[model samples]
Target: MLAIGAAVLFAIAFLINAADMSTNDVFTSTNVMLIGLALLALHVAGIGNGWAGRRRR
Candidate 1:
């Protein structure tokens, strides 16, 4: 799920960059891309797996 979120973020960033849209400093394509990368890292690290509350028996 986090990976999916990251992919969406990356897509948004790419679109923003490709379109050359003007945005605030905090919402720039680079910043969005960084955020996406962070999410991807978290996903890889087993964070937000959505299975922590479940028990396997």
Candidate 2:
């Protein structure tokens, strides 16, 4: 859930940043997008699996 939340928050940030790209710069927008994407990947792969669960042998 935490990861999902982080991913959502980051995505929002990315969207906002993207919208302001013209006022800002390309690097900032690209960095925000990259971070958001990374968080989203972690959310789907880790948090979605229940982070505290045990693994099989």
Tell me the tens digit of each residue's lDDT in model 2 across 1-57: 646666666776677776764545644656665766776777667656665767999
lDDT of 2: 0.64
Backbone clash tally for model 2?
A: 0
Superposed model 2: Cα runs more than 4 Å off: 1-27, 48-57
Candidate number achieving the greatest TM-score relative to the actual structure: 1
lDDT of 1 by residue, 11-32 (tens): 9999999999999989999999
Q: Could you estimate the TM-score for every candidate? A: 0.88, 0.42
| Maximum-lDDT candidate | 1
Per-prediction tally of clashes = 0, 0
Off by over 4 Å in 1: 53-57
Q: Rate the local accuracy (lDDT) of all candidates.
A: 0.97, 0.64
